[model samples]
Every structure is written in C-alpha cells, then in structure tokens.
Target chain A: MMFFEGSEKKVEAVLKPGQASLRQLGRPFWAKMVAQANAEILSSIHNDDCDAYLLSESSLFVWDDRFLMLTCGTTTLVHAVTEFLQHVSQDALAMLTYQRKNEYQAQLQKSSFADDLASLAPHLSGNAWRLGHLDGHHNYIFHLDRPYCPEPNDATGELLMYHIKGEDADYLRSEGQNIEQIRQMMAWQQLLPQFQFDDFLFQPFGYSMNGICGDRYVTMHITPQEDSSYVSFESNLPSEQLTPVLNHLLKVLQPQSYDLISFNMACALSHATGVQAIDHAEQALPIGYQMAFQHFLLPSSQVRSADPL
Target chain B: MMFFEGSEKKVEAVLKPGQASLRQLGRPFWAKMVAQANAEILSSIHNDDCDAYLLSESSLFVWDDRFLMLTCGTTTLVHAVTEFLQHVSQDALAMLTYQRKNEYQAQLQKSSFADDLASLAPHLSGNAWRLGHLDGHHNYIFHLDRPYCPEPNDATGELLMYHIKGEDADYLRSEGQNIEQIRQMMAWQQLLPQFQFDDFLFQPFGYSMNGICGDRYVTMHITPQEDSSYVSFESNLPSEQLTPVLNHLLKVLQPQSYDLISFNMACALSHATGVQAIDHAEQALPIGYQMAFQHFLLPSSQVRSADPL
Candidate 1:
C-alpha cells in the first residue's frame, strides 16, 4: 500500500471542551474520518479501549479534549478539515497547525491549509508556509494561529527530521536488524517511562506504535519493505525533553539517515549552537556516517548566518 | 501533476509493419489509447506534427514501426497490453519489454507483466526478479524473456542506481547546474554525434530530452524540486559504449548522486571487474566524493561475491 509513498503530515488541534477528556468519543469519530479520507483502518484502540487510532499511513492521538492526527501517502486529508468541524463545536476549535514535508507536488496542491485557516479564523494575523532550501537542507513550515513566527533572537523548541540511508538503511531493512524483536524489547523498556502506548506489526512487514504522555504524544512508523524501507519519529514534547527522547529512539531504530525538522518555538539558540547540540546528541552514529546537510530558518529580523541560504 | 511521483515506466514494443515508418498511423492511435487510459496530454508533436507523444506523466516515441512509451505516476499501463493486441495482426507482434523500478507497491501490484507474458508465450522458461541489497546497494530486475540471469561468468549489462544526498542534492537542484543550457549546448556539441533528438524544459522546472540513434535510444529526466530533486538516465546501448556516454552526461549534470541501471545482457564481465570499470569511469567525480556502494546480480550458477547481500 506504499505506507511511505508521500510525506508524513502532523496536525495539532487544541480544543475547548468543558470535559477534561474525550477518550470515549475519539475512536469511532476517527475511524469514520479515516474511511472518509480514503485511508485503510488498521486499528483504533491500543490499550483496553484506549483512544488511539492507527491507519496504514499515519496515526492519531486524542486527549484532554485536544486532538492530533499524523499520516502520510496520497490521503485526501483536506476532507478531514470539514470532518473536524463536525466533531468540535465552533468555540471548541481553539487552534490548528498542519505541517508536511515539501515533497509530493500533487498532494501539496490538493491541500488547502491556508484557506482552511482563513475560514476557521478570519482575522488571523499570520498564515503562510516557510518553504525553501536553506544551505543544503530543505525547510517547510505551515502554521495557523500562532504561526511559526518566533522572535529574531528567540530560540524556540526545535523540530528536525533525519533521512537514514546507506548501511543504516541496509541494517534496518535486513532481518538481522530484528525490528520486530526490537519492538517487543522496546515495549518492555518503555522508552518514555511515563507513557502508556499501543503497537502493531503489519503482517509480513512494517511496524508502528503510538505513545501518550499526558497531553503530549509520540509516534513512530517503520516501513521495512525492501527498496523503500523508512522510519519516522515525531513528538510534541517540550524542548528540554528533545535530546533524551531522540537519543532513545535513535538507539532502537538505528536509521541510516534521518531528516530532522527543528521547529524552534521560542528559544534563544544560535544556528551554529543548535547544529552542535544536535550533532552531540546524535554522536552515537557510527564512523563514516557524515552530517552531509545542515539548514536554519530564522525570523525576518534575525541576523542571518553567513552560510548560503 | 507529480510527473515523478511514482516510478517512471518504460515499455518498448516492436512491430512488423510493411512500411519502414509508422509515422502516419502512430500519433492518432496513441492519442486514442491515451484518452482511453485517462491521461491528460501535454504535447504529442515536437515540431509541426512530429511523431513524439508526451503526456503529463510520460513520453512516447514511434519510429521504424517500433514504439517506446515512457510514463510516470499512476497511469493504468496494463490496459495498453490489450490495446497493443488490437493494433497489430497476430503475426505482426515482434517483441515487447516493460520496465519499472521496484517501488510503488500499489502500482506494481496493478501491473500484469508476468501474466501478459505467460499468455503471450506459454512455453517461455525463464522468469525471476533480481531482488536484494548487496553491500548497501539495492538492485531489482524483473524480465519477460532472457530474465536478468547474468551468470557469474557472463558479463551481462549491469544496472546501478546511486542516490545523491546532502550537499550534492543541494547543488543539483540549483539553477547553477545549468542543465537546460547544457542540453542546448549538447544539441550543437553533438556529444553523441550519431543521434538526432528533441528537448523540453518543463515550465520553470525540470528537463527532459529524447534522442534516437537508429533503433537505439537514450532518454533523460531531471526533476529539480528542492526537496526531491532527482535525475534518471536510461539507454539500450552496448556495454562498450556505456562509459564514455555516462561520463559526458555526468559531466553536464554533475548530479550529487546518480542511480545507474546497467542491464548486463549477454556479456562476460565478472562482478569485481564490472565494479572496477564503473569506479574508473566515475573518476571524474570531485575529491571527497566517494563510491559508497556496490552490488551485483549474478546467475544462480555463478558464485556470489563475498560482500554482504
């Protein structure tokens, strides 16, 4: 089914429900939405009726009346916008953020993130994608409400993606990499000790798991098919928790290459400093593995780095 | 439309028309077939009703009663199998070859290559795909007739694909690569002095050109989008002609990483010898660039290489 054909998208939506939890209402609602969005339903419950949804392309988490859905491939996600409206009252639609990699031209064209934002918040002051290649890396940021508009000197929570290639890709796709075994070991290890999670191993191939830590969530999808094997990790954790969490995931996955998207929310780190921190955190990478690309996206008033953008 | 979204497919069919050319009959027939296949047309004529057919996803060439259609994305190409039957008398069909990379599970599942071949020639004995990752290099070859059964002793044409990443990917996607300009210069430079060709620079991005030298042909497609810039080259030329031809194109394209598919057909080159030839041919690559991978598809009778597969 090409679980990794297109870009994996992550959407975060805040809610205004009077109740503290929407656990009971979230599962069936998402299954219907996935069917409507033309995605295959693999699972909708992780723990005994816990509200976690896993589709072939991506996953979704619902908590504290807030919701987050992440998926990939040529899914008709725009339809989910209207469906989201049906689930939440107008007042409960507090905020929304949609982000995707800048690949897949037709899929991107099919999206209406800007129009959807305008309809949801008519007077919004910030809307637009930060799209372009900076240095040797590509950055794509789509925002609604509080746009990805950190102050020039502010170093916000960073978001990053890494693409594993070469020997790393070989190891992960090989049986010796023992991904299925790793998944079992991880379940016991509980990388995030505080979170309750759900996992699924696709018949004969692929692996995915979703974890919930209070209001925040983290998910991973491993496409272990021969030619296009890939693995992705995403979370909405605080900046302080980024390195340790990333390190733990890296240890398990051992991806050959990874594309890191650091959405620096409101921090004060400089470009060089940020890269150095990432390099140190990922120093577990084996020898001959090179940091072949690096990029930085700064606010308009920030002093630009001398490197080519 | 993401012309490069899925794997690009190439289908070569030979016919036994009485006339030397199919020029008068080819265009309208393909236009009808494309309409039936539900594809949008971009151009079918190169210069004043020329015989080339270019669709949003693929291109077609008709000459000497032979046809080659190359298309990418999700086009229902299997339908063309029946369409070919209608176009020719029972005895007029000569040979057919269909090629696609081992990506796109949905599309690959949709293909009826093996089924069609079985119906066409039930007694055919050879069939198998060259599928595996050897020494960090992935290779996939499925055949209709001879099969990619290169004996360890037989030096069949070798197929190789290299992925350029990081800084190299950055440089190739930039306008500074001057590929379109190189195409113009090459038209006059006559790098392959024996061929005549037509070229098109996609509006604001990408470049594609088709060249014919007798029954042999060469084609190139470069997608320069920032996030997924890629270049592909394919030909039916002999092994003796490959090195010089590849060197010229590499010099002009300067792709950071290239995937070369050398289909070793009925040759006697040993595995190590073939890799040595490729390494020597690519010596023009700048310093610090490395040959990070090597793989081979040896026949069952031949001993496999010591490298991990």
Candidate 2:
C-alpha cells in the first residue's frame, strides 16, 4: 500500500462578539474552503452547539463564534485558512491558534509550518514555537500574539499514538473491516455515552469519526497500516472524562509510544501504567492558553525486543 | 535555509571477468550516468586501485572489477544505477548490492526504496531486507541472489552521525567557511596522513571530501544545519584503522547519536564513552558478506536538555 500521511494540520479560531456566526457561513462555503486544501467534506453532523464535519482527510467543527479545522494527507491546509481569512477580516477574530504534528512524511507536504506562517502573515500576526526534538516526534504551534481571557471550560486534550500493536490493530489493518466493528473495538459508548457519533470506513483501509454531545466533542482518525500505524483521539471534554478516554484507547490500540497534549488544561496521564514519560514540556501561550505536552513510551522491558538478524 | 535530505542512496556492483574495467569507461560515461541522477561531477581523484569522483551530492568510486556510487538530496539515484545497468549486461555482473539510508525527508525523493527495487528487478533478481524500524533510523538493502566469495581484506566501515554539536559544527554551518578550514577541522592530516584528499565546501553551508590511498578509500559528507545536522564517514580500511578513525570523528563531531555499519567486519564501538547502543542488528547476506549495524545515543544526562517552552 502507498504511504499516507496521517498527521494533521489544525486551526482553532474564536470570533469577536460582534462577528457573524460561523455556522451561518453555510456548508457550501466551508466545502469550497476545504477544497482549497485538496480535501473534500464527506458528511457533517450538527448539534445545538456545534457542526462537526467528517472530511475525506480528517474533520472540521463549527460553532456560533468559533471553529476548528483539521486535515491530513498532502493537503495544503494553510491555503484553506488563508482563504477563510479572505472572507473574514482579522478584526473579526478574537483568538487564533494553528498547530501541526510533525509528519511521518513531511517532505511530501506542499508547505512547511514556516511557509504557512509566511502565508498567514498578511492577515494576522502570530508567534510560533517548536515543542520537541526535530529528530523525533514533535509539534509546531502558531498562535496570534494578542492576549485575552479564557473561559473556565475552554480546554482540549489530544492523544496521538504511534506504532500500534495487538489483534485489534491487526483487525483494523485487515480487509473487510467495517465502521460498526471499529466503533465497538474503540468502545466509545462506554467511554463517552452522552455523545452521538458518525464515522466512515475508507475503501481498503483507514477510519475517521466525529462525536458531539451538546457543546463538547470528541473526534478520532485512524491509519492502521502495519508499517506506520497511528491513531489520534481528541476531545474538548474536561480532564476527568478525557483522561479515561485516552487511557481506554491506549489499552485497546497498544502503541509503542504516544504523546498527550493539553490546551488550557492539565495533563494527567503520569499515573498510567506500563509507559514512562520520555519527554515533557509546557508553554503559557501568549493567547491566554496553557499548553502542555508529554510523550510516553513502553519501558524497554515491556517493549518488543528487536528482531534477530 | 530549506531542509536538504542528507541521507544517501548507495550502489555497489562487481563486474564479470574479461569485462572492460569500470575505470576504462572514462569520466564522460560516468558523468552521463551521474547526470541521470541529476547530480554534476565536480572533480575527481585517482590512485592505482580506484577512481573517485566528487559529485555535487556525494561521491563515486570506480575500480577495475567493481564500482560504488553514492548520492544524497532528492536525486533519483536508482535511475543512474539503472542507466549503468542498461549498458552492462546482467551477465556482466557477478554481484550487486543497493542500499538506502532512512531519509530525513523521504517523501521529497523521486522514488522509495521499494520503487527502486521494482525498477532493479528487471535487471537482476535480488533479495531485499530492512535492517531496522520503519519509524526511526533504518536501512534498506537489495542484493543480487548469487553465491560469492569475499577477498581476505574485503571490509568496509561506515559512521553516520546525527545532530552534531560543538564549535566545529557551528563553524561548518557558518558563512565564509572554506575547504582548507574544513580539512583542518576534520583533522584528516592527523587521521589519515597517507591519503591524498580532495574536498568541497558548498556555498551557504555543507561539505564533501574524498580521500584515496592506494586501493583503500575514505569519503566524508557533512550537512551541518543546526536543526538537522549530520556527518557521515565511510572507508574501506581494515577494522583496526577504521575503528580509531570512527572514534576520532565521534569525539570531534560530538553528535547526540550515531550509527556504526560494518560489512564483512565487526563493529567495535561498544566501549565508546558517553554513548550507549540503543539498537543493534546483524545479517549474513546471501552474497558472502556479514553486515552489522549499531545505533548509539548519548545517555539522557549527557544530551542537552529540552528547550524551555
């Protein structure tokens, strides 16, 4: 199978009080914007507080005054954000944050984070930071330089797992796997019973899902190739709910290593068993958010031994 | 500066007896083949046993019976090897080996190792093996399936250093650096006084050198960017000479990690100070070569701490 880049480029933006409701921009407009990134909107679901899109590459979410867009593969996501900025003036934005997980095949990407920063410079000013080693798993963040207050409930947690193992992982890689079986494998019902879910199983392989519960949401994207398996789980739920959700996914996927990221929230996976934190860093973003990142790996004793020559 | 892929694609082939000596093929023929890979022949050096050409990307060594070619960047090296194979019948090759180091930017390349293997399959039957994890530093090898015997002294050692540090590395990256300064910095005069050296210092930054002493040869390539610094030292010298050379380079480069690769020779870096082997693998190739690979990294305490976020 050809390699597919599963890591995502993500953007989170909050509109000013007097701005037009983002939901009112309509799906067609958002579809055009997504197309600018070389991705398509497969389908979308809506709740009273949000609109969650299931994209051909990843997912996008829209609320009255804020939205989040994430796309994977070789999508030029910066172009999509720039297109959106052309429609909405910078004065209409209260806060903006863009993030990119270091890619498995970064050279395939149409633009680097630095390139994206240059493209976005015309519309808004921002500060960027790289959070980990360039030789290993890392992340890049670009946020508007403006400062502001955050809602007590404004929090996000993301868990990115790599080199997954076990029968479940094999099943995901196997042919004839379906969405219902994957949902059952993930056990989202037990993990987030309050949310309503929508998911898609791609031809041959891959999976994506979006769940919405009033204002809070959880989304997942899975690429299960044996050579470079990866699964990412993200949620806006409080830490108590998010931590268990992350731990549950880790138990089922059983990755060799994983990274936990929290925005305006505390990371609590230090108590997880079997894995040790290999790297950790935290930053108080200028845009009124506390960002913490921690990478965990199975201890050498627990990790699979190297194959004998 | 834009990121350049520092990893190399390498090819080694042994021609049949009574065939024209590879050196007799002349610089023009080899230049055409190198041009097929989009690299230019800068200059060349010769000794009794080999003809070494310094290419814009890396190096090439041609002997009467065999030739070794290496090139980095986004060059389509498989094309060059394929071009050479077109002129030399498969029956004119007793043995052949193709190798590729895991690239820092794989997707930028014109073809993956698998693609190269497919292209080569038409020219010769071969067995391919991966020597390490796909998610980290690894190598891919494709060797013709044929019984062979090695010369008593048929040995090679290669040292690949990553994330180099110290004032020497900074000097290599800085503007206005010259070939003489680099030669002194690398200390080849002390390290291999017998060998005659020809080196190049790339504009902006980078270095490549080829040294020849009778039949044995040593070559070096340096990509000294701060974010993704790398230096590689390779030689066909015996283990005793090769081991000390590697240790001296390690001491001068002060890299965070490095890989020692030995062919028909034992790897002897287990006692290197400050670093420990994180991965090791070995294999007996069908073509009468024993290959061993070891990856070493500084202990956590010695590696520079993470940047404060």
Candidate 3:
C-alpha cells in the first residue's frame, strides 16, 4: 500500500516566534454531562469537516482530560494526514493535491512536502495531538538508566517519552507484577507507532502492541517544528530503592517556538521530577520565568480546522 | 510477517458413516485420541497452503472419563503457539483455517492425482475438519428456501448435513430466511481464497463473484474436508414432512446416510407472548443435522487435532 512505503514528503514546518498562548474557553454545558457532550460531538461531525475540528476548541474545558493531553505537541503533516484518512475514511490526498496546486507554486513540485501537508489540513484545526492514561491513573513514574544512545545526534529532534510503572519496581510483594506489566504494555502502545509504519493497516496490531482499545485511554505521536541540529531537549528524574522508576524524556530537537499541547495530570509530575532531579546536579530552569506553558488551557482563539479541499 | 497472514491451518476432520466407533491406538495426541468412529471424517484445506484443518470431535472429556480430548482446535494452536513464542498475535489469513490434509507423499513431487493427494497427507490427517462456531452454540439452525438452484444429474459429493428440529407445522411456516444466508456465507469463505493469488492480491475479484461477507449474523462457513466423494451412511427415521429437506439435499449432494434426530424438551415460545409456548413445531436446530439422526442416542466421541501440513 502507498501508506506502507515511507511517504515522499521531506519538508518541515517553519517555527515562528512568540508563545502560542493556550486557554480554556467558556462552554454552554458541563463536561460531566456526557449525554449532552456526545450530542454536541455528533452534531459537530455532521455539520461538515470544519465543524468537527472547531468543536474541540469550544468543547475543551478540562485541559487535563487524558484524551486531550496526548495531542499537545507540534505534529508532522504526514502523521496528521494519515490520522484523518484513517478516522474519516476520506480520499484526503486528492483534496489536498487540489489545494496545493491552487495555492503553492509549480516549483514546489520538486518536493512532495507541500502536497503531503496540504492533505492533512482536513484533520488539524488549531491543534494536532492526542491523550494518554494508564491503569485509570494519569501519573506513573519512570527512571531511565540506559546510556545515551550512540550517534544520538541523528536521533536528535526525535523525542522519546516513556511512562513506566510496574516491573520497574525492585520488589514484587503484592500487586507489583501486574502493575509493571500494565504500564509497559501502555508505554509500548504509546511509543511503538512512531517507529513502525507497517502496522497501520492491521487492527491495532494485536493485544500486546496496543493499549486496551477502550475509550478510557489513548497515545499519540507529535511532530515538532524544529530539527535536532538547532535545538535539543532532554529530561532526568528520580530513581527508587524498590520501584526504580525514573521518568525521563530526551529531545534531540531543532530549536523553535513550535510546541505540542495535551491534557495529562501526570505529565506535569513527570516533567517536574525530571527537571528537579536534573537540577539537583546543576542549573536552574531555562533563563525565562514568565510562566510555564499551560497545555490544557489554550487561548480562546477561534481558529478552525484546516479547510477541507 | 507472513505468519500473520492466515495461511495457518486447524486440524480438520469430517464425519463418515456408521455407529460411532473409537480408535484406541495412541498416536500423536491429535490423531490417536480422535477415536476410530464408524463415521469417516476427512481433511480439508483453505487457501493454497493447507495449514489448518477441521474435525468434528468433542472437546476433551474421558469416554465417561478415560482419555482426554487433547486435540486443540483453532484456539489450541493459537494459544499453544503464543506460549511457545511469547504472546498471541493476529491471524495471518482469516481468524481461523480448519483443515485435514492427506499428505500421502510428503516427500517426492508427483504430478498425478495420487501424488497430489500424497503431498496433502503431510497437511491433512484422516479425521480432522475445522468447525467455526457462531457465538458459541455448536447446535445452530439455518433455514434454506429458494425457488430453486439449477439441478444437475450427478452429486457434488462435497455436502454438509444440517439437522433441524422443526415439526411439520413449523416447517410449513418457515420462511427459510437463515438457510439461504448460511449457504451463501459458507460458499463464499470457500471461494474467497482465489483472490489471494498473485494476480488479484489487492482487489478481491473472488469476493465479488461470490457475493458474501459484509453482512451480519448471516451464514457461517464451518469447515472443509479432503474427501470429495460420498460413502454409504445410515439412519432410521420415516416421516413425510421431512421429504422436502431430503429432496433439496439430493440435488446438491449424494448423502450416503440421510437421517433425522430430535427430542422433546420444554422451550418457551413467542417474543411478544412472553410466555413459554410449547408448540409442536419444535423450535429450530443446528446448521447441519436431520431429524432421524436425533432419534439415535450416541455418546460423545474423542477429538484429535493434527497439523495438516
């Protein structure tokens, strides 16, 4: 399938300056009113493609909702395109190709980058990301002890964020065995897709390769705006005597304002521990202290999903 | 990756004629336990490679508690394999492939009809045929009623026996809604493999020609066997109402032994009446069974599952 072969796109998004301020917007109904929320969700999808994308903007109140948190990062045009076609079963490429021809220059044909991205406009509105949760709990600690990967330079700009819980523990006194397995199982679902392109056609790639397909949890992959050459990001966290879990994220990323936003209460702690533990050895937070980026709360900007071709 | 493709097979066996017999000779747990029944069941394959076959043996239970039914069906192979490797994966072909190969000549290549059957010996065992169950009820009833299918003089020895419990009154009221569907679905699964060949790998010309799948709660393709001809079979039942069902089968198959089986058990009737209506038109029965066969009482026999090649 065309999907199996790595797509023909090579161009990356240009990260512009300034904070992409995020905020929670006022809504007519309570988030807990699932019945009401579902009705709105359906109506939005029925109104045409754009309505579905914008509904999230207005619908989002609990920035910490696991489903919302997974999509916080800047994503690639390629990932975005695939998600839309997969979810909606639409002929996305054709629409995007038409749009690309109408707006971009003929020379762009030298590369498929613009074409690939244009196809994704249908799926991404102002935000492009997903949510993550494990064992009904959002916070799970993890400690990374492995040495930095060699030639890690090429892998830069590539961020590997892992969530570990159970087996990472030193002792299996009670529920330890099951707890560790669940977390690893959850993390595999979150991380593996970024590496595998073949499983896209298969139904969730077996039970082992997937988190439970229940609506309770989800994992996402985001393509950031920068490459590793310009910027790099990494994190380190605490280890334990028994449950030796220290959450860490290493980013070999290009420098830029591009970012991802999603709702995960644990993400706050995972990053916090990493920063605190890393600081125990050296350095304070990056120079600026204006404020930490609040992911769940996006500015009430009424940006619509990219117009459908 | 290829294994993920459903070329894998199930140990399949077909029911031959005569009083149920037992084969005491112990062999590979699969074939040995499959008791030597007077009825002969053959090995059949789906797809080009006869990986899995089917059988009509009962689940493990001692003949009143002697030997165990060690022959594992689809669930057996998949789970055992999962243990051997480390995790259960998805089906490579379809969910399951039931078959019994007659690998008469598992070695040298032969072009004749005899040689072709020999290579099959490695794949199919004499008493193996896969049974695909719906929900979990093995005793299923399908009503087949069509103006008519073109009748030919000769029998297409390949036949399936569906036992029904409908009384004369019930038979008259039968709309045959289910019978037609079950036939179509089973036929399609049998014909569906052709498209898997090299030339039509992407588009399924076979499915289109067959006109099946995509529908729900329809007929289910149960099993396939190696024996293409009929052997003499017997049963004792004399009834006039049953004539239509027999006549119907005669055109499609040369049933060696046509029989009916039934018993009176209290069952509720009427979706609206909400009361247990014990009407003489006994409810429905399994997909392949006649009334005469029901009159005869037989003990559960052994089941042996073998790897048909």
Q: Which candidate comes out best when scored by DockQ?
A: 2
Considering summed lDDT, which 10 consecutive residues are worst modelled in model 1 chain B?
B282-291
Give per-residue lDDT, candidate 3, residue B220: 13
At residue B307, candidate 2 shows an lDDT of 40
lDDT (Cα, tens digit) per residue for candidate 3, span B118-215: 43344332211111110000111111121212112201111122221123212212344243343342243343432221110011101101111111
Q: Tell me chain A's TM-score in each of the predictions.
A: 0.65, 0.95, 0.22
**For model 1, what is the error of residue B84's alpha carbon versus the real structure, in angstroms, after optimal superposition?**
2.6
User: TM-score for all predictions?
Assistant: 0.55, 0.86, 0.17
- The residue pairs found clashing in candidate 2 are none
> Compared with the real two-chain complex, what DockQ does model 2 have?
0.20
List ranges where model 3 is wrong by over 4 Å: A1-12, A15-163, A167-309, B1-309
Residue-level lDDT tens digits of model 1 in B28-97: 6777766644554566444332356656546677766666776655665546645655766535544455
Compute the lDDT of residue A134 as modeled in candidate 1. 17
Question: For every candidate, what share of the true interface contacts is present?
Answer: 0.00, 0.16, 0.00
Q: Candidate 2 lDDT (Cα, whole model)?
A: 0.82
Q: Rank the candidates by TM-score, best first.
A: 2, 1, 3
Candidate with top lDDT is 2
**Ranking by DockQ, best first?**
2, 1, 3
Candidate 2, superposed: residue stretches over 4 Å from native: A35-44, A106-129, A144-149, A175-185, A202-205, A270-284, A290-294, A298-309, B41-43, B107-129, B145-149, B174-194, B202-205, B270-285, B290-293, B299-309
lDDT of 2 by residue, B1-309 (tens): 357768778899998789989899999999999999999999999989989999996899999999998888788889998999888888889888898887755556788777888898888888888675555566778888888887889898888888887888888888888888888877899989899888888889999999999889999999888877888888999888888788878777898778777789975663446555555667888789988767666533422333422
